[model samples]
Structures are given as C-alpha cells and as structure tokens.
Target: MILPPHETQAERDASAARFGAELARLTAAAGLPLPPARRLTWCTAEFEGPPATPAPHHGAEPGPPAPDRARLRGESDRYPPHLTLYRGRLPLAEGRPPDLLPALRAVSAWLAGADLAAIRRTAPFLHVQEWAFTHERTPLDRIELNWRVRMQGLAHGPYPVAREDVKALWEAAFAQPRLRRLRPVTSHYTLWFSSTPDYPFERVGASVEPLHRGGYLVRAGGGEPATVATAAEAVALAVAALPPEPV
Candidate 1:
C-alpha cells in the first residue's frame, strides 16, 4: 500500500495560513462588496453531548446553539466552525440584479479548503445545504471542508487513477493463461501478480501501471518496464514474463 505523507502540527498550521492568505486575495478579486454586518465571519459551536437524541421533531425550526456553545474562531480540522454571511437574510431570487454569486462562491471556496474541484463548482452555486450554518442563518457552503482539512493535514492525495477505470484491465490480465494462476495485488495505481497469496511488494513477478498519456507499462521483477499501447498487449506482456505455476 502507498502510505500518506506525514506533517507536524506546526507544518499544518503554516499550510493553513498560506491557504487563508491566497483565499483572501482571491475573494477580494471576486468583485463582491459587503458591509460589516453582511461580510462573512467565522463562527463555531460545541455540542454538549450526542445531540438531544430522537433529533428534534422533523421540520421543526431549530433554535440557536446555546450562547456558550457558540463563538467566533479561526480555522481548525476538528470541530470546524462555519462563516456566517448574513443574519436573518433571504436568498436572492433567481436572476436577481448585482448577482451575489461571487460572495457565495468565496464562502464556498473558503469552506472547501484544499479541494480544488469543490471550489470551482461553488462559483455558480449560491448555497450548499451540506455546508449550511443554520436554517435561520445563510445557507452553509463547503460541508466537506473539515474532512478535507484533516486530509490535508495528513498529506493525503487523490488517487492517480480511479479504481473503476482499471477494473476491466485487471479482469483481462487475470484471464490470461499464464497469469491465471497468479493472484493480482494492487498498490495505488499499480497492479502486481504473484504466485504466493502473501504477495509481498518486492516479490511480485510482474506489475502493470497505467501511463499518463495513454498506454500500459508492464514490468517484470526488478526489470525495466515496457510500455504497450493497449491493455491487451500489456496483459500479454505481463503473462509472458510471469513465472510458471507450481507442479
């Protein structure tokens, strides 16, 4: 398995500072101006316990979190707070003039933290329910920011290739006559075949990895890899290099 990178708390803090600085600069350039009352402000709440149990009747208007439970705070991976954009405000109707989309996007981007795609999608979206602060308050944005922040703190990265994209390739490779007896193991983007069930990383007989532009790269134990144009060719190459099954 590919391990994630490690970082100290101090390092994470520094990264957060850098992210905040860039976000501020980008928001300023987004072209929306607001008064102090309407400007976004970070706010947080601490629940006393495992919710009131039975979770207040459905559709019942929720009250403000206890005053002591609420406070304005800075960014944090745990117990992340939200930025309140407005007080008792209604959403702008569709096609409203002056288009406050920029402000909404800024808030969403802030909440999305390091998730580049989420930030991009928020620009055209006015509100994201998952990230909402409160029903009475402005709709929240970037509900997943806290998780993203934690992942960022841990230096986790998105997978290079989606598993679904390579499912067929693995299936085809496993079907090859010479490779059929070998068990396929995966490590991130790589697929390895080993006769042993344990299949230690170093002992795999053959491995295949997808090339960036378009192709499969096949490698035999510690040997140079050969890039093939198609999955079929890659499977054939790997099968040829694989060791014969035990008697």
Candidate 2:
C-alpha cells in the first residue's frame, strides 16, 4: 500500500500561505485588482494556480529521493492556472482554466462594471449558479440556475428559507413519530430525511422545502411534492408520506 505523506499543521499552513502568495502575485501580474475591502466583506476574489512543486509522499526506508517520490505522485493533479471565483467564502466557479490573461481581463472588467445591488441579488444563488468570462466579452450580467443539469430535484429556482423557520421546521420534524427514525439533514434550504446518520447519508427517504411564494413542499420516496400552507400541515403530510416501516 502507498503511504500518504505525513504533513504537520505548520507545514500545511506554510503551504497554504505559499498558495495565497502565488495567487496574489498572479492577480497583480494579470492586472486584476482585488475588489475593495467593503465589497470583499460580502464577496471575495480568489485564484487557483498550478502546483509549484510536486506533492510529497513516503516510500520504502531506502527508497528514491524526494524528487522521485513527487514523480510517483502523478501528474493529473497539476492542472493549468485558473481562478476560483467566489461569493462570500464559498467558491462559485472552479476547475479547467480558461485563457489566463483573457479570463483575468474579463474579471477586471466585470468588477469595474458590477454594482452592489447586482452582487447582493446574485450572492444567495451562487451555490446553484455558475459564472464564466472570456477575453471575447465579459460574462452576462445575470447568473442563471445551471445546477439542474448536474443535480436533480427542484424543477425551479432555489428554495429560500429563513433561519427561524428552519429551526422551527427541524423541531417540528423531530416531534413527529413517523420521522423520528430518519436522520434530518438541512441543506441548501431543503430539509432531507435520510436513514444514514453520517455525512454521506446515502439513503434519502424524504425532503421538505419552503416554497418561494409561501408554504412548504414535502416529498417522500421520490414522489411528487405536496404544498401546505402551515408548518403543522407540512409536518403532518411528511409523516404520513413516509414509509410505514422504520427507516
């Protein structure tokens, strides 16, 4: 078996600092000034550069030198220079570097032209949207829901929810005897029930999402979602929809 490289916390931090430094250098070199501090408070600009060095790895006691170990680590991870565009702390776009100078120029132009209202309106949808730019022209002003192509469910835009409502929904779901066996996972404004208790939660059994216009949409076993006006009605519908056997 191949042993993973042993990396200390300090070493990891140093590596991160190096990456950040390189990204900053590239941003300047490309003439893409960072957004103002106030703008950055709500959004961020980030770059993902090609690896500067080969990754470290362990080998047999009398094995090859460090250089050789890096070679064995494989070349697939060494991608081309790219930007990791962000909204707040979350990355909105990554992977597959576009033309470096062209992309940076597009980003610069976008930053200069974009307004606070536009950013504010787009920020919440960043998780389910994608943005791209090229030297040919700056990207479109609007961010679209491109997530459906990759992910299923939610035939329309994202389901919006308030923190207070989410807490109330979680408590209400827990109080339901039928849903007690299923684990509750709240993500992307949707509350999912899964048989597995851990992160992967492979066995999803039901879901509840708040409708944009008002009301909650509850679904079970891949069936159609049913909307109800009140949280009590939503919870009751969810409990009734669940499988009779314990999940």
Candidate 3:
C-alpha cells in the first residue's frame, strides 16, 4: 500500500506524534473522554464489473494461468484492494454508553434488508485510473459512511444506550475542525476488519480488472471487499433506504 506523503519513516513518526498531541487536546476540549481504541472494520460496496484481464506492464510480460474459480479467487486477492478514501474513529463513552449497540443493530437491520440488486444496477464501475489522485480530489458520486461499531460493542454488550450516545458523540465529533477537513461522503456502513497493524491494504497486487464482468474481488492477504463507485446518486441510493439519524 502507498504510504501517506512523508519523506521518511522518522518524518512520518514525528508528524504522527504532533497530530496525536493535537488530537488529545481537541478531545479534551470536546468534553469527550477517549475510550479504548479498537481497530475499525470496513468494506466497500462497489459497482459490478468484469475482473481486469492481467496484462504485462513496465518491461514485464503476462503469463498464462488456469481459469478455475479457486484459482481466480486466489488471483483476485493478489490485486490491490479497493481504497477507502475516508475513515473515522467511533469511541464509546466511559461508564457505559447507551443506544450504541442498538444503533448498530438498527444499521445492521437496514443492511440486512438492503437491496443489493438496486445497488448493482444503479452504480457504475469506476476504473482505477479515475482514482489515481483520489487523495486530492473529492470523490464524485460516492458517499463513504463510517461508524465505530466494534468499540461500542466492546464497551457495552448489546446495550441500547451505547448506540444513542455513540450517535451523539459522532455527530458532535463530525463538527470538529479535524473531522470536517477529512470530508467523508454520506451513506456508508461500518463493518469490522483487522486493525491497521495488520491492515490488508499492503497486500493488494498490481492488477486492474474489468468493471462489469467479475463483480468485486477480494485482495490477496487482505480480506476486505474490493468495490468502487464514482457517482453521488449511486451512493445516495445505497444509503437512502437505511435508517435515518437526526443530524
């Protein structure tokens, strides 16, 4: 996986330290206490398409491989997983939070009842080339929704207050300057995945797939979903039927 822009490891570390200090101060000012941080799990609901045919590039040539479902699954895992342009942390309140778990269950219910067929039909494939500079450009036709469900679950098991407080905390947190700068798209889901230390982005191989034929593929070593969307309408459609929260 491509690292964020920093000249060296030392530079990256220094920057992180500085940011962490600033974040601590901000959290203090927000009247919010930091709960035990947990790794976030996430997946992308991408547009359906054919897997990109492997081709030779940069002084290399393509090699033929057998076309078996098991092999294809393995091959698909070798390519770069779809990128998540945005991420947010959801921490549970101390002394046990309320409505958090229920909120997650509510979201789960909505997702369980989600119409995958509509998402497939409405959303179109976004070529990798289109995402070359996603870090700089605001995504078009995509809204990335993030929630801190795992931390909430750990803090309070299946409690209704956990969900409510979490929603409030997130709403308040989103209004902060740091989060506003991140510019997340609306209408996405939060699923559990391995933490950053074991994040799967690094395992993505260098292959592009066709958009319409293969559907989304899993990256090798990274169990995260591979999906991409380029249109806001499609994102809205995906989340439109989800449970609504008062902002």
Report residue 10 deviation for candidate 2 (angstroms).
Answer: 18
Ranking by TM-score: 2, 1, 3
lDDT of 3 by residue, 1-247 (tens): 1123456767666654553444345445554333211222111111112233343332112244211110000001222222111111111111211212221222222223222232223222211122223311332211112223322333332223333333433344344333322223222222112112222322112111223342222222333435433222222222332324358
- Candidate 1: C-alpha RMSD to true structure equals 15.5
Candidate scoring better on TM-score of 2 and 3: 2
- TM-scores for all candidates: the values are 0.33, 0.33, 0.19
Judge candidate 2 against the unseen true structure and give its global Cα lDDT, from 0 to 1.
0.43
User: Which lDDT tens digits does candidate 1 get at residues 14-89?
Assistant: 5545544444565467643311222222222111111222323222223542211111223343322222221212
Which residue pairs does candidate 1 place in steric collision?
A: 131-140, 132-140
Q: Is candidate 2 or candidate 3 better by lDDT?
A: 2
- Please report how far candidate 1 places residue 191 from its true position, in Å: 0.3
What RMSD does each model have against the real structure?
15.5, 18.6, 24.1
CA deviation > 4 Å runs, candidate 3? 1-4, 36-247
TM-score of 1: 0.33
lDDT of candidates 1 onward, in order: 0.41, 0.43, 0.26
lDDT of 2 by residue, 48-150 (tens): 2222233232211122222100000101232333333332222333322233344444344334444323433433222223322220123221111122121
Candidate with the larger lDDT of 1 and 2: 2
